[model samples]
Target: MNRDIAIMVDLQKLWDRKVEFEDGISHHEKSIAFWEKKISDIRKDVSVLKENLTQAELEIRLKEKKVYELEEKLGKLQKRRDVIKTEKELAALENEIKAVETEKDEIETVVIEEMESAAGIKKSIEKKENELAEAEPKMHEDIAYLRSKIENYAKEVRELISQFNAGLSKLSPEIKSRFEKTIKSKEGKAIAPLEGETCGVCHTSIPVHIVLEASSGIKAMNCTNCGRFIYKKENV
Candidate 1:
């Protein structure tokens, strides 16, 4: 291939490498983001579990306090029962005692249920804590590795860009200008190969003479339809 076309091809290769590095960086960044979100979600779950446990404990305490009050009332009523002289008074005392005992039983049942719920909550909290403990380190390691990969990709991108610029500088000003314009217009691809009589990029048919010229590698040409610089694959 002509020197200018060869330079353009090399420049395109450099551009591809730079894009590859940038893509790698992007992929790693996305992975880091995903892990960050997962960590945040886990932490939120742990917080909610802790809140639930606290609420359950509070309810248990309140129910136990009610039970204590009922028991105290029942004790006082039983002590007073012996002093009652009338059958009616004794019957009233017994009914009062019975009522107090019943209330106490109900409250005790509630407290027991609440205690059971609290125990379950504690177990769940422990499980979640363990999960967080295990996941946190792995998440950190993953993020660190991804960041390191992105840093390396950044360096590779810089090197590729430097190489592309150096290769571009070696071309004639006219060729450089044309290459730049063509790259911009052709979505970063300034050059393509001819296959048979077809432009590789635009798939347009090339005239016999232009195909012959491009195949000869004596000169660099553009696809008549797409205007991308064209060369023969064998020549490139």
Candidate 2:
């Protein structure tokens, strides 16, 4: 019974180490994912800013063309006014010139606004690009360090599994099955030490006879309340 208890204890200890290492690896993986997401989002934002600048430049060109066409029409009307035969024709030509000039003025205003917007967009793109450049190296370094830690954890877990398997081989089939079931139900704790008259894990009082039997270490004893195998810590 004592040998079985020893086997279970050693197995549990090894399993606990495996869990610890695996949890560490999981934590580092999450950190790496977070950094990757940040980099991707920054790149996407930079792309959007660049697209906005391109669109603004195209709009500016179209507005400039409209202004040039309106100005050309105004110039032709002004030249026609010199040959006008009546006051009405002269007035009509004046109206046409004024209309064209007004339209050109509005288009020029839009062009100026678009140019300013393009400048702002360009500046924002530059700032975002710089930020991405600075962050990429640091993020990559951190990811590499995290990956190294995961690799080390994986190596240690493999070693622990080998030790656990060696310990497992010493246990009887009946005891091994019982231990597996207990660990599954009890969150990896298949055995609990006796604490005074109670089970250390569940803090439930044990029968006097059962506590005495467990203390003798004559056989492995189960706690009545929690069904965990009981061991005497001092005897061990």
Candidate 3:
């Protein structure tokens, strides 16, 4: 019932609520982190697909160039027929042309296959990008909501801290120091009401004199067993 103990009890209740809000903030932060990881994974997949498309495009270009060179070689070989001086020479030139044509056909086939593959890769990339574009906004919206919740919790904690400081400043230096020590030792709880003759924290019996001093409403006292500041409540 002492003024100093009353102030500390109020601060302790506010601190208790702050702890709960801090827990809420942590929960929201974890959810945001989860969404952020998903976004990162999606972008990573897109990047890998793009790299694959690049490689496929490069290979297709090389195959097409090879086909072109083979065509040129076949055309030159055909022109050699005009200058052939023997049937043997004609046969040799025909064989050379056939070989060049065969090689060109094989390369062209590969080029077509690679072009299809590249097209498929491009389609995959587009689909993933589209998915990201659509889903990213929703993800961001969810994150924003989570952040807003955290902001609200943080704001409450800040206000509680401000009010708690104001209340704490009203106490004498000795009481303030004792409250800080007990709050730290007990993790933000510095006072407990007497439960009959029992210590509310440790459930130990209160000594006759300590209980008398605390219940007098003149001074606050500590539990002999658990070292927590003890108080007696007046009827509301």
Candidate 4:
């Protein structure tokens, strides 16, 4: 294990932390989107309720008009009751009047039922409206907070990346390129650390001959078990 490799592993750790912060920011954005979509869906539901109420009212009005026309026909038929008409004709008119009255009654019942249903729909719409009114501002606030967090996290990542790159520039090009390649290939993981006398990334034990060479920190060493470079850490 070499000191330069250790430093590369430390840089990878910083990169990992940077990714974690970025992921947190992404999570906040997704949360904001979820709430926003919920609010939108609720509003659509409220709009549908309103349309339902309007249609229900229209149906009630149509039924009421039918009842009114039936009553007018019944009155006309009753007026002809006293007219000198044939017995059969008067009977027919009476029957017609009765039928109209029955239909009018049925229409009135339907109108009443429709009106009740409309009232229920109106109540639902009102409740939904209140819910939307309360939710809209809160959703907006949540989105704003999420956006702010994302922006702050982005700024912090930029600063960290600048510092990381500045540190990387101090190393040789070959070592830096190798570290970058390994970091990318390992998904931001450290290439090496001591894991119970073996390389954490490579799972290889250090031979006594190479152990001193690695511990001396003169050059980077590759693990025999896995090809990942090994680095020595003083604290560990």
lDDT of each: 0.85, 0.88, 0.86, 0.79
Residue 64 lDDT in model 2? 90
* Model 4: per-residue Cα lDDT at residue 62: 85
Q: What is the lDDT of residue 72 in candidate 4?
A: 82
So what's the TM-score on candidate 4? Answer: 0.84
**Can you write out model 3's per-residue Cα lDDT over 12-129, one digit (the tens) per residue?**
8887888889889999999999999988988999999999999999998888888888888887888889999999999988988888888888888888898899899889989989
lDDT minimum window of 10 residues, candidate 3 = 180-189
Task: Estimate TM-scores for all models.
Answer: 0.81, 0.87, 0.70, 0.84
Q: Give the TM-score of candidate 2.
A: 0.87
lDDT of 4 by residue, 107-189 (tens): 88888888889999999988988998998998888899889999999998998798788767766777888777766673565
Per-residue lDDT tens digits of candidate 1, residues 52-73?
9888888888888888888888
Instruction: List candidate 1 segments past 4 Å from native.
Output: 170-188, 199-213, 216-220, 223-227
lDDT tens readout by residue for model 2, 29-89: 9999999999999999999998898899999999898888888888888889888999998
Q: Is candidate 2 or candidate 4 better by lDDT?
A: 2
Candidate with best lDDT: 2
lDDT at 9, model 1: 80
lDDT-based ranking: 2, 3, 1, 4
Best candidate, TM-score: 2
Cα misplacement distance, residue 156 of candidate 1 (Å): 0.8
